[model samples]
Target: MHFLIIGGGFVGTALACELLKQAPAGSSITLANSGGPLGKGLAYGTQSPLHLLNVPAARMSWTDEQPDDFVNWLAGQGNTCDGAAFVPRQRYGDYLAVRLREHIAARPDVHWQQLQNRIDSLTPEAGRWIAQCAHGPALTADRVLLALGNFAPACPHPSLQALPADRYVGDPWQPDALSGLPADAPVALIGTGLTMLDLLISLQAMGHHGPVLAISRRGLLPKPHRENELPPPQWQAPAGWLAAGSLRSQLREVRQAIGRAQANGQDWRDVWVALRPRTTALWHRLDERARAQFLRHLLPFWDVHRHRAAPQALAVLRAAQAQGRVQAAAGRLLGARVDADGLVALQWRARGGQDTQEFKAARVFNCTGPSTRLAEGRRGLFGHLLHDGRLRPCPLGLGLEVGAGYALADAEGREQPGLFYVGPMLRSQHWEATAVPELRAHAKAAARAALGC
Candidate 1:
């Protein structure tokens, strides 16, 4: 039976690799990705050495069963760095590419096709799925895995919503979005996440001297890397706190638990490491109300603590703040209109019911992160699937609805055969599906289900 994986990011690559490792010889597998092969997507395609991974190298293996896989590959390439160190993302991408190439070279019996074409839609025919590529002819596969990763950011503000291309920088991942701006033009960064940091680095590299205004609801910044700390041994949290208690109370208890760990000379990273395994379980325990409450009230705080910046990147952010080049403020955008200068005019309300203030940005960039609502987008195969009743979105609209085994559900919420989702697209169902550890496990499980093993 032929297997088709849509997307060529880390999850897709790892899935393809794992299938080849376990499946019988001569198995046909086709990986359809617009960018082709390993490091094809945005996360791995970046060339900046300054951009480091949030997780350390030790925790970023392709599989938990193979703990030292990535580090060993890096070592084989004559890299003498410490195994636990957080390496450049570019190096990680290179490692993935090297492994993919080695696997392809060694697997003579397996036919792996890397098609550099986007999948426009998926149609079911004769117990198989037909994937229509943007340019190439359609290919039929017995099983299909949707491994598509990140989506473009969703702008929530009207000032941002009605922005024209000339007055906005829609996608921060593309470096050219910041190109050709006047050297001294005042710029506005919509969110203060890692993507915002990336744009800051790009601007600094280009030697742009304009003041940057980064505004968010809380103006929260990512915590910096804990570099000097050792590889933290796992520690246990208060039992059942994350599951049966209120989120606010649980957070307080967790804060107290961290204090206790620190008193014992252990770092908070240990607590974080321990929580990683139970995050999904804890998230699942929360009801819809609790989940929504967490999203509304605790998401910003959780994100700042969860996704940290590299030490080097943190230093840049700190230095910029000290120099007054970067301004982080908390406010809600009230209204936005176009001015005579053809720029975005924004009204914002400050913290604690302060007076509304007006600001005009020569360029307003949306770094608010990925769009979770699939139906909101004009393109993508999932939208088409939803419209045709092939798939229904999760209640939260975060992704396609799926069952426990990651099997795609129909419009009536019934499980569908031969269709599976294996990455961040399952975020609504599994909050922890976005990263490597969870993704690798999900890929393995999906492979097992697909192969009937």
Candidate 2:
């Protein structure tokens, strides 16, 4: 059997390792990725020590049977990282690469190879999938996995288009995005999410003591993980909660569950931790309207609580805010234009006020998060797949729809043969799909399914 995995990031690389480990005799595994490194995707590619994994080392193991693989790896050598402590993401990237190399060496019977090219399209022929590469010849595979990760950030607001290249940085992940900024110059970040925190950390790492302003509609910062977590409560979700099909009922029940837990000397986070296993099932139960309501009304609250920051990382940010070096405001950006003083004049309206306000900064970085509309557009692989009627956008417009076993669901609601996907974009089907714990499961399942048991 032959398998092709596209998108060489964490999911892709992990899937390749899983395929190699579980492949039957005389199988071939090909990983196609034009991205920089094998396992260091955007999340782990950061060189900043301040960019730490949100989850603890113990929860980040990629292998199913070895949940302590990551923390144990950290224990090897003179390193003594605590299993419960959140560590640098760069270390996790190192872990992924090291594991991949080790797995490849251990699986000498499997014909393993990497194609350093972006797969442009997948066409099925004679029970095999032919992947067309950007700058290479087409390769046929018995199975193809789309591990396409996050795309470029969507424009935060319409006014962002007015900013000139010299004054604006669209993608914070760019190697030179933070370059050339004055140490003490005012810097405006367009979002108050985790990426904005990353920018702040990167700036601090570079000895930048600039006055940083992060603007968002609600100006919400990610909540920090508790210094000490209570044990996972044995409380069970109420009957019919997962099948309620009403967002209001589920929301109310979740809040009540957290309150009851708190009353019993447990933390609210314990409720969330306990609910992790059922999140996907609950998402499946909710209809389109309920899902939309959750996105429109509850997403922000869920994000701050569910996707929290490491305590150490948040402490630095809180200190910066207390020192007046960093500030966050609830405002809507009207647009930006180059002013007469050669600075970027960021025009915006405060959350509740009608009058427009202006703030001039030497540089601006867009950290509003990745674009979700690319799947609907006609530009790249997503578009080509949709145009070919092989892809269907989810009703919430968040990501592509996947059928059973992570198979690509066509526009006609049929599963595409020999094709599978396991990535953050699975958010459409599994609402809590982006993090390492969730994605790692999907990667292993998809790999095993592709191998036909």
Candidate 3:
């Protein structure tokens, strides 16, 4: 048997390791990624020490079955690291590569290949799947897994749309995106998520000292990790809150759930963890209207609580704010234009009131998170799949809608043969799929299911 894993991000890499471990000798595994590495997807590819893991090292294990694998690996050398502390993401990427190399070395009979190519399309032939890559010959495998991770969110502003090459930083992951800017240039970051923190640290490291403006819908920044003993959440979701309920009821239930979790000595992260396995089921349970309502009303609150930052990063952010180097505001983009001083002038309205404001900066970085519109993703493979009726977009217009077991369903609600999807792409189906703990679980289950056990 042969398995072809696509994407090569955390989920895909994790799936490859698990599949290789369980497969019998002579089974073949190939990882196809546009990015030329075994690990270090866009999120972890940076070498910045300032970019730290949001979750503590102790809780960020790649596998639930082996809790200490990561920490133990970090412990092997005379080099010392605080095991429980969040480490640099570059180190994590190196660790993933080391593990992959070790697994390949141990399993001599397992054929492993890393294809540095973007799979353009997938077609079924003779009970197998054929993957066409950008600059390589087609790969034939018995099973194909779409691990293609998040695509950067599309630029939302029209002025941004018209800016020439050096005017805006559209993609945050590209290393050279901001390389040419002056050291002290003012930068406007589009969102206030972890990526914003990353850019902030990078800019500071590069000696850029100009003011940083971060704009978002809520203008609300990510809350810092509570120090000392973490307090419990203050909301408890009501019964039947996520099922067969109106949007208002669902919102009330979520607030209640947060309260309950806090009272029970758990943080809101606990409620997020609790909702993981049931996310797909709940999403499927919701009709189109309810799903749309959830997206419209609850997504912002869910995201801020869900994708949090490390305490260390939070401290830095607080310091920046105190020093008046960083300013955050909540609003939607109204318009933008290049000003006489060679800066991008942006107009936006604050969240609650009708008051509109303007800001100008030497550079504007689009950090609004990954693009979720399925059709516009333009990765070719996904677009082709959707265009050919092999996959359907969720009602909320997230990624390709998937069913239980991470199965890709067709327009007619039929499962695609020998094809599966896991990770953030399943967000429309599983609201909690993007994070580490949930992705790890999904990878394990998906790998097992791929084996036909």
List the global CA lDDT of all models.
0.80, 0.84, 0.79
- Root-mean-square deviation of every model: 2.0, 1.8, 2.9
- Angstrom error at residue 324, model 2: 1.0
Q: lDDT tens digits, residues 312-363, model 1?
A: 7878878999999888888787877778987678788876667998778888
Candidate 3 C-alpha lDDT tens digits along 1-453:
989999877887789888878888999999988885777887678878888877666566778988777777777744355545777887777777787787778888999888888888888899999888898589999988888887776887867978766778889878787878998787789998877888888887788878888998887677655443133444444555576565677567667887877788767766665564567777767777887887887777767776677788888778889999998888888887889998888888888869888888777889888876776646488788887789887656687776666678988888887899987877776666777778888899999889876
Specify the poorest-scoring 10-residue window by lDDT in model 1. 228-237
Can you tell me which runs of candidate 1 are displaced by over 4 Å? 238-243, 263-265
Clashes of each: 0, 0, 18
List the candidate numbers ranked by TM-score, top first: 2, 1, 3
Worst 10-residue lDDT window, candidate 3: 228-237
**Cα TM-score per model:** 0.94, 0.95, 0.91
| lDDT score for residue 110 of model 3 | 91
Q: Which scores better on lDDT, 1 or 2?
A: 2
Q: Between candidates 1 and 3, which one is better according to TM-score?
A: 1
